[model samples]
Target: MNKRMVLILKHLLAVDDPVQSEHLAKLIQVTSRTIRSDIKELGEFLSKHGASIEPVRSRGYELKITNDRSFRTLLEQLFLSNEPHDPHSPDYRKLYLIRRLLLADNYVKLEDLADELYISKSTIQNDFKEVKLMLQTYGIAVDKRPNYGVRLSGDEVRMRFCMSEFIMNHSEKKQDEGLTSGSRIIHSEEMTLIRGVILEQIQNYGVMLSDVAFSNLTIHIAIACKRIREGNQVAMLSEDVKNFRDAEEFQAAQHIVGLIEKELQLTFPENEVAYIAMHLSGNKWFSGIEGQQAQDIGPERLLERRIYELGKEMLTEIDHDLNLNISLDSELLIGICLHLKPALNRVKYGMNIRNPMLDHIKTNYPLAFQAGVIGAKLLESKLNVNIPEAEMGYLAIHIGAAMERQHLNTRAKRCIVVCTSGVGSARLLHYKLKSKFGNRLEVAGTTEYYKLPHVPLHNIDFVVSTVPIPEKLSVPVVVVQTLLGGGDMDHIENLLAGERKYIFNYIREDLVFLRQNFRTKEEVISFLGKKMHASMLIRSSEGFIGLVLERENAAPTAYGNLVAIPHPIIPQSRCTVWAICTLKQPIDWAGKPVQFICLLSIDKNGDEPPSIMYKHLIEIVDHPEIVQQLLKCETYEEFARIILKHNLY
Candidate 1:
């Protein structure tokens, strides 16, 4: 592609309203034939890539791509990767004319089309027949209506494919011809007005008034003008165009009045003017952003607000570190806006949202640079929600970091030191814990024993208390029992893995469990009894149910990825709800697979479960390796070992 075709695609993408072929031809500086061919070419491009472009009645083509980071990324790269070029090679000229005639807004006069292409009317007719036949292969058909003339309808893809082949043949010639001719016909004022319309729409519509919508609208407006000049009694406006009027039907008529008075330099009767305005107003040809405004803040402001907020949220969620900050200047923001606008459009329209250029953002704004993993996950889970590629990339970074941190820590277990105040003995206790665990056990964050009342007294993988233990704050608090033998570090590694919660920005609703043989229902009660050790009735439909597991909704666990892990971060009851179900076949949870269901209940009033269990759902989903092992496990023992031995957060 070259500059002109790119421009054409841009225009086509921008159009929100349907337009006539005549309008497209005029706007692009091509004969009706050339305009039609371009549309065909565009459609073909969309399909070959597994994307879509649609045409509406009295409107032009609209693009439809799956919404996701990957697609958004693809579209941005496509536009930015290469420049536009000529569509028509030498051999495609014949098909090009056929495309124009077929796609023209109104009926094309056989004589007029033939005269323009320097071919006989019969040749034009024959070309139409071939095009029509091709349409059938794509499951589309040509429709002929009385008074309305010849038209094509049916499967959108077919029309697009046929159109693409035809456009590819002639786009080049049209581009050259368009450049020389378009410059002479289009005025600066017109371009200015068009640009104004686009700016306004972007503000008013937010993401809805997409780039494709704008491009198509521009073509339609230009074509509508041509019909009026050709004595076609086209619609024009009767009243003055206001910013926000309820009687919009008359706006098109008014705009037409403005166009003629300005472009054609003519005046019209009152009724004719009203009809024109009505037509323009009723259709999407007019600017969708007419009443909206965009802030004139420098690019730096836009970047700071959007990038900083996004970055801060990312770091806080993924890493406990809160001191980092990211900032960008106006120059960088301008580039982001220019490049990211297209990327955003693609994502909003269900295309890939990821942009290769995003890598450059780090180089340009170094402070803001964090791995794209978290940012990408945040984008996919909260913004795009379509592509998984970015999210996957993010996961790799997270897991790598986790492994790195683990490697650096002298293979120590975690020990929570508790004390009152005075700072002297507390400091000594902390030093001792660190000295003893130094490569053997890690010292988690420190807190006062008294403050423990307000905080959830859980997640204490191991605790060393200088003072008498309170009734609460449980994790195996070792009363410093003589402060001898250092302390058993065998279980510290497991606690380290379990205590941290790795919140995944992306969560899918689908969960699949892969295991062999169902655990006997009786096992449910046994397991729950061992875990909870509380007297509980076996609530069941027919036979004894597994140990009664209870679930509490102290807080919500709904994250992204269409997934929600609901469990009491802390078990409050001795009775646990143990239930099992073996799907005859796999069922999709959200969009994944589901095989096993685990419900846990704890007696917060008594013994406390490990803090690692607090982040049961989040940690499991975040670690792909763990999820894989769990999915492939064949037995309950194996699954239990995997769950118990490995850390979730």
Candidate 2:
């Protein structure tokens, strides 16, 4: 169906309860009558796909699936359809306008564009406001004439880069399926031919590229070919071209261009060949040496010493802030050094490469992503160049891999069993633990309650005691019966999994503010900052709020699900803590709707890594049901109960 109908269907599928038409209208920014009409049409469409929209008497609509298999297939087909986006949708209309202008050969009249989209001229003019803002990011501007309408004007290189972003790339398409945009700048056959030629040449020349890099290079070449035929060519400085010509990729670019010249019957300028070589250099992959030691691999030997030094600095900064303990990881060191070499080239040349795994990395590995942000800040400070979110995402992948490696190398949870009855009872509990947890738990022998203080607790993760130990000890004490019940086992399991039994350790009742009326992100942050300052949690409200805003400016913390976990750029608190606020109405947080704000302040001098805390926050961020429950709570008690019930999942 249309884009709005698809959105309605997706929303209905997300929630179990029936949704009111007013809510749907507000969500889609349409009238209630229009939502009803769309729902009727959607119902007819779904009837044939083994699903239907049922109208509840008091409530609005709910999706009902008749056949699970057929409904799943219909869903797959619906999302995969190549139909043009609905023009009535504002987002789609904006995209349509951008693509039209980018591909236009001459200045087309605004009235003509309005007529083409079946929209009023006033509406098209309104859409141009946002379109202009978007184009401005790429250093492009609309040159509007007196009566001739507007045309895209920018540096030729920047124009092509913008074209690559909005025109050449489709989120749904596979990496190998190159240049499947609606612009049709190059025919499918020509794209295939160009890709095959590049693949053959790169393989022949012993140059390695990831699938994403390979596809991107193909798109760039295709764009260059199309632009050259249209009498537009990229101009580079002579010294820059001379430098690129010295690289190994320059030879590969020459061979690849030579073959494509015969196939396409078009001659590329020497500057264009150098441009291709630049892309090749930026996309190069070093392989088959991941397991080598840092000294043996010698990052300085593989790349410029400056890049290796910067990589070390990045790791040191991340370790200092997040305490990830990965600074000494040899594999991670090599990976970062190798990545920085090409990354620096791409950034210097203003090449914007897409990271396909960015969303997945953000959702699944937030701590690592935070570490990536720290690394990005270091790079920006040292190199005096801005690193984009996409580049930070690539850095996160390396840090994430290293984090996982560190986790794997950690030993199993070690604890001693303390029984009051006798040695036999403690032995029974120890064997039970060994049998239930297997290698995940290491039972470090038995101990009497009276002799617990003599037992070396420093080496233990925690102590499983049968009798009550009133006095506090160095290690955590889990009081259990001589015979462990399911509940007791679950408590032990949580400890083993590095999860806190109570989420209140981080989420304090005094820090929670419910049903606040916040109009903007700044106001919400200001409110939380004041509350934190008043509570003596922070030294300066302005400094804390500024840091949080700085991080938001770098990259938004709103991860959808009506949730946002905003935090300072660096650790600013004495201990890791959260100041939470639930808004009475959802406000726009960097374009995402957010009603739940969790202001995270990481411990500046924490000995333990914050990965587990981030893991729990991600669970809350990813679950819409939890956010919904949290938004409904009017009191701190209600909120805490809900969080404790979920127990940080």
Candidate 3:
């Protein structure tokens, strides 16, 4: 465990409310002098970051938070990111402490934390200094009270910026030495504002980011600032930033500003040496230097192309109306506008665009509702003719902001369960697998080892096995003696951490039905039929699938495990809708099931087919006990509950 982590955990576990340094030192097994140094370090970090961590003369530290959902959200994300570290790594202990303390959530005391982490109070105190210093880099300030405790003070924007930078820059510095992006010409104050907006947006949307992703974003923003300072022009450089193995990528990002100087039609001044140094520091992109051949794709060129198309289209449509003329280049004003999108979304749509900045097209864009309307009209008349005006307006905002903002893709990790056989423990293992995963994981499928070699588990990023498999498994697999208890969660956590690097770019685009209605399942299906011109098919024959009762008095559908599935298998008439409704009240299905009703509709003879839909229906039917839980489900987001809890999917 990291010393810093141990220290933080010690405080959280041991320091209940507030206590004197002497008492804290005794609890943590450290001297009073060491505790004092730690306290000083903590105060310094807080002060620099614009958040306050106050220490009481006789008592201990207290953390104070405020409104501004963005900053609060950013802080939470920073606390959740846990990176592994070498025991000897500098501040490794502090980073670990930060994680535990943030998550303790007022549960354990500082004294208990000391006992758990096995660190001295003085060592714990010193860890605070590292925290305060890290926070300061992003403009958060920490304040201490005479006796109350330590608190963080600063508005949401500053707090968020400080948190992001601290997490991204400092977290990896211990392992990847000399890979820092160094200081740039961008003002610290301005950088804070930009960072705050980006962090706020991603968190609000519940998007997950990995450390590599966060680092890339940090570097991208830094480069954008340099380009903007050189001259407000869209920069097109030959160097690659991805797969940071090639030195050319480093040089490309470094001299990116200078490379576009002539194209940007901007004059440079002396002493703006950061841009020149940036070009030279091309070797220090992130992590380490490699000699691999770099990707040829240029971000600037792609962005320019997108901007040109948008600008040309906008001009052709409304040249007579707005008379807008815009040119594309990577620069500052664009970066600023990109940052503003998330802040604006918070102001406009109660959310933020994940992309840091969007591609810029027209030079001076309007921010009013009227601009929205005009953009909508132009897009409707020219591009995607099928979309509605309102959708066009929303798309306009996304595209406009996407052009200017920096964005990151968030992907969920998926795991598949391989059963040794189908009869005995397969069902038990299936339930156990989903139980092990919860929401963070996507459980693809559970199949016997005999069939596993042939079963194509879609999106199965990794695999877990109980018994040895006769054939070679394609995906990464972790063998376990049993599929229960602490071992499962640990394996799942590791799998999720590995999968975090790959994100889904077009998450919603692939699904045809749910794209329209993300909130409710019924709504999604209804939209598919009504808006998409697709019809639901139902079978009309007498021998067709229909619900049957065994006794004169039908036993309660409540299958006794708090699960119930109610369905009427009637013959199909015309292609009709299958009403899958969840009752506000749980109803009795069989003796064991809870309240869940799933209606399946089979299409009569027609061009529209039912076979494609039957396979999905069978998956739901075989799990009637599972379907009962679906009745209680209220929305599409709850689909995970039905799938994971019932093992229906």
Candidate 4:
């Protein structure tokens, strides 16, 4: 399939609903006529493959797969075939260059790269800027020979780490296409043998690795084998690997290394062996029941205590910064402690693990991901090593699971659907909402609009209505179609996701600054800081600015779409509050531009849940339209009007 077809398929795959041709045209940046023609062509192509696009009179097009196996095959061939990739996509080019550079023995010239990708040399060189940044994170660097070409060079361990990350990524893409992409990296038989040896050793050592984790190890080992054969060996300090030297995991690593060396007829450095053992030691792979029993038989080791302490310190920082109040969660604490054993190793040895769920994790659970960053930074400081984004993503999985565990006790928002049409209609709406939202929403029961005054507003979170409720009630009201259609379901789901936070509670009329002439984030923060200081809410503007900067250092508040939620790194106020400032236009805030700044501050002693304070703010951070509306507001009334219209409170 061509780029246009791929682009169409990508958009179609995003949602189950029939997307309008005009919408698709706008997104694809093409004429509606072009999109209609392309869709027709794509339908024919898909019909021959395994899927077909069904066009509706008003709804436009929806894709249906006739045969899953056939479609995956088609997708694989179209994706994995030798073809020019999407150079315009930063991810595609960086990934392409990573795989190409790793596989090439000689220096790869810029002209050769440009010609291969059908892009200008300048564009190829520009792509290398990102490539260089990514390589630096892994301790790998680009070696330029002035006139010759560019190649990668780093510590063997680090080089292997980069290669594993890139190669495994390519492997996953190919795997999705129902194909294997690593034949040139390792022979099938040798890969099988290597995997067998590793699995046997893991089983013998009584360690449990998820299939993905096992595949990750297999890929890393394969890459290591290839790199080692070419005379590159991993390096590690004696002190750093001392723990691995005498451990049972070390013995397993040695045996695995010995078997691989025997089979491949290549000698490996002892450091490389230790690095292998480090993988076993540091990997968060569960050790079946037997290993747990063995551990239970003995008291906690010194290393375990240290790891636990480190995990505690990280969680403490998370609690201090985000105020998640999950620091004392026994399960969360244990999860992090267990995860750190392997995480520590990965960081120290410059090892990378492919978290297939990284993007999904970041997109779905951003707060947890940011918490993971803080946790990773602490791990970095404690271990004196850099934590790559892939590893940060894994940390997010642990943190996200822990956060989810904490959420188990949270009360689902109690909501009632008002359908005054009749009892049957009201009950239908209630059951439909119950079925759609499940545990996310608690249907308190149906209420007639006429009898809404009798319903307890104290217990109710919100009211979902088939008919408009003209009266401004105590709780938020969401007006939806009587049929409770897809769009309505999404609106309710978004509310459920944020738990319908009280955005009005934190906002203040006096603090809302609209359409200000600020041209920098510093100016915005300074203006907000001065406002807080003038009200005697803060001791000094300088101190508050420093706090804001410190929080920025932890993780930028900018969440894109010209919005930022700057706050002190730690709670510095006696009460929960927010101060807002809008720029005349978007100004650079970190790498992203920001037009609306919401300075969040919380009472460290308040009883409010962490979700209540910042969750609604995250909602605002995600909505460019709301930010735009707020930015346009010249008065607090206008600003509050937009928030009311959004019904976030």
Candidate 5:
């Protein structure tokens, strides 16, 4: 099947209900008639593979599986094929163009590229617009000459970084093996040799590198070898080279390079050795250093002191903003200090280290990720360097573990029983709660309804009352029968175990917009910001919108599942609220397709931690079915009902 048919099948497999041909056409940027024809052809292919596309009258097309085993085998064969390239797919073609330009020793003719891809010059020109934009992010540019065509031009270090990202780290190829373009730079056997050399040297030097860091270092060395053989060499200042020579990592780099030179019969310049030493210094981890004093780890006491101070400041900022109450976590402080040492080196040298857990960290630990963002911003300002999202992800893992530790160390929920039936009934309810919840429930005391006013509630989590308390109080009041039933026990248990509030509590009816015709992320954000301002929910729409955009520039807020939760860098409203907009058609958010947009504004003055709110949002991000249901709602009532019905915690 062609790329369009493959996309159609993937979309059909993603959703439960029939998808309209108009929707498919818009998604693929094709005409409705073309979609119909593609669907017909795809149906024929599916039928032979134990699956069929059935058209629903007045609706659209739905995929049905006839044989599960055969369909599974077909899916594996189609997706896992050993095709080196797909010239028919525009995305693949753009990647091919980029790899070709990066590997080119001189300017490559655009006509030659067009002929290679079997496409017209006009199509390739259009493709270059996107490729150029992508390259600009890495500070690389397309150097276009009138008759000579185009080639990649940038700082040698940045070009090598780009190669590591696009050629060596392409998602379609395994990391252990090289892609077609990467093979030109370094073969699998050569990569194995480089890895073995790195392992032996690091082992000999007592240096520890994580699996990701090791892979990145290996790729950098391989790229260095390729560039050196091609008569391209990295340049370093004399002072910097002298400083690296004094570091212990320089000795290890020398040994690794000396062995590689013998094996590959290529000479590495001194600057190349210094570059390898920089990578080693930036990626090393202090293994078995947990709980150890910072003074004992490094030779430079002043640098360790500075890192510790920065860690303390970062934790303080996180605690003040989110009210996580983890600033006093010594173990967390030690971990952050240790991590910052290597992280600062990587950031200072503009080295890009990949975090394999970035997506999982964002989805599973959003609150911690937000804290990571806060910490990264602080570090950026203090250190005068930009911290990439991958580094922020690593930071979040430490913070998330600290949050988990805080949770584990928490005391049981404390409550006071208020009964109108008298002391006897209050005592009965208190004992029943104690019997049911065990040590999880701590009953401070019981009191009569009239005397409850004098009962101290400062330390209580909630009020367990037999009679409904009409008057509002500081703590939540859960009313149950004199003889507590199973439902009442479950309610109390949820309050004790789950810190989450109802998802709709933060959602307002006036703020929910359904079936919006927003064509871009900017349009959607601007509309929501204006709505919030008009409703007097925020002080200034422009200021709020600018902050949201700044956060987006730092990292895109689109977290898959057709959802994009755009929020300010910090809390911007007096109270927390969500301005939700569901698009009639999906918009490209950064790179992900987003149909559901939740504009979040945290309460600036509230004492409650935002983690509970993030938990509810994570529930929506994790469930595609819930997002689809929300996207289909056309009215506020329908949206509210769906949110309340599927409230996970």
Candidate 6:
């Protein structure tokens, strides 16, 4: 019914456990009272759909479905409604308008757009202003005609690239659960055939692809086919394509194009083969090729050697920038090398690969993602290519995964599966688990509910089951769908909470300074750096300050609220501590006004992971109210009192 109501329903659908109202409020950046009111209103709407909120006092609320069919119908009506998106919201309306422009076969009228969105012509014009700015990034322009309305004008390739971004929106690898949605210009069967052909070729070439990259390739191929039939072809520099011809993936790409051309009854231009090769090189597929080749051959290729060396340099820069211990991760080294090989191709060809998870990754893993940006910067330094934000997002995925792998290797859980589903279903679920968890989870074994008793318990940390086990067990039982759906990994991560502890001890009274009248970010940072040096916490003040400023140049650490968590690019301090500075008033931090500055300096030789304490800091940062309260605090005890109430330790 309302935007908030839709958000609440989605959350309820996502989780099995009752969601606390406070949790929902924090998630959407609202207050508990607003969530409570929305819940009551949402409950009324759900009642009509054979679903109702089951409120658990002192806990939260859960969605109970009475009629599964009706609930599904309601979900479809709410999400996939004819309105496209909630026109009431500017964001949804912008998205709706983007889709319309991307898919339009003819010029679109401002009046017609207004009518579609149920908005005024003036509003449509204003919205189009934003849309034009957005399309400009893809090198597309709004070409307006008298009485003919407006159409997007750009290079056919750029037009198609822009279209791919909005059309399919890079829907997740899975069928239905991605945050973004895509379009289907052709029949589902045709697309399925295209996907099958691609996969067959990938296997024959002895290469692998991440699911996200695999899905991205499928959609790009589909777009290419559709564009080609309409007399549009990708034109590239002959020299660039020739370079690709030397690549193993170029040969694989030619085979792939030959198969697609035969099946679709179309021909691929010589450069188009290189274009396909670029796609092969850009995504996780290249890394897959690297992985496959490394195992089969004794020595690395020249390109592979370069990639490995460049990757090591990139990681060195990243480690120097972030002071994290991920450079030593062998898996990360291979992954970075693989990701970069194709990424270099993208830069060479002037191609853009949109990363849909870009925003989410930035928000979730600020430090790791920034490290990725620095990594991108390093690649840019040598490659001499202007790395776009989208490419940076793609880089972050690999770096973040590599960082996560370090955690997985040390603290990942081992679990047994209890399934009522048949053997075929059980196998699918097992692979899905592996795909999601990777090295983070080891599957002890899978057994039917009746045979679950025979499954060893001591060796297994927990149980993942298709059916609910009512009896009390020593380990936690995670009941999931037979499909091993979207939110399963998150639920599993929560179960492994015991494995990792938050480093709350990092924040000390000795490190914190309050109510300081700092006017600029530089002043706040300089003051804190000098203090740390004077106290013998840091070896050099200017050196430490330079590292922090360098990191800021890479990306702003001012993550929302009135709080800014600034830290040196690397660990220069003797030990970890939060060198905090609460400004007497708000100061410009990057662009946002920040009243609280938390300068985190990690111990060069510390027991904790860099990201663990960073994650803990984020929990406190999520609460603007807490930050504001801390700003009001003038003494160490008062600040400690407020932070201790969070009970993060």
Q: Which candidate is the best by TM-score?
A: 2
Q: Which portions of model 3 show Cα errors greater than 4 Å? A: 1-412, 421-424, 481-483, 499-649
Rank by TM-score, descending? 2, 5, 4, 6, 1, 3
Task: Pick out the ten consecutive residues of candidate 1 with the lowest summed lDDT.
Answer: 547-556
Q: Report each candidate's C-alpha RMSD, comma-separated, in the order given.
A: 19.1, 4.2, 28.3, 7.8, 5.3, 12.8
CA-lDDT, candidates in order: 0.42, 0.83, 0.40, 0.75, 0.83, 0.75
Per-residue alpha-carbon lDDT of candidate 2 for residues 356-409, written as tens digits (9 for 90 to 100) = 667668767888888899999989988899999989999999999998887788
TM-score of each: 0.31, 0.87, 0.22, 0.70, 0.79, 0.67
- Compose the digit string of candidate 3's lDDT tens values, residues 1-649: 3344335333533223443555435334457787767766754544444444466564455533333464345444344443434544545665544434322223434444455456776766676788778666445555655544455655433433333333334434332332224322344555555455435543543333455444444444544445445443322222322322243333333343353344444444322223232222321222221112111223233233443355445433432332222223223223223222222223221111132211111112222112334444444455443322233244345334533342122356676777675546656766776676666566676776667768775568887777766566677776655446676566666566542222221112112121121333223233322321223232222222222121101212222222222222222334423434444433333222223333333332322323223334445533323443454455566655456554322
Candidate 5: lDDT of 269? 88
Runs in model 4 lying further than 4 Å from the true structure: 1-84, 87-97, 108-130, 172-183, 240-242, 290-303, 316-325, 353-396, 407-503, 516-520, 560-562, 583-594, 621-628
**What TM value does model 5 have?**
0.79
Clashes of each: 104, 0, 121, 2, 0, 3
Model 6 has an lDDT value of 0.75
Candidate 6 residues lying further than 4 Å off, grouped into runs, are 6-39, 46-84, 170-184, 262-265, 284-303, 318-329, 354-371, 386-505, 508-564, 572-575, 581-597, 603-612, 618-635, 645-649
The window of 10 residues in a row where model 5 has the poorest summed lDDT is 172-181
Candidate 4 residue lDDT tens string, 215-260? 7778877877887877777667888578678887889888899999
Better by TM-score, candidate 4 or 3: 4
**How far out, in Å, is residue 521 in model 6?**
7.6
How many backbone overlaps does candidate 1 show? Answer: 104
User: Could you tell me the lDDT of residue 523 within candidate 3?
Assistant: 33
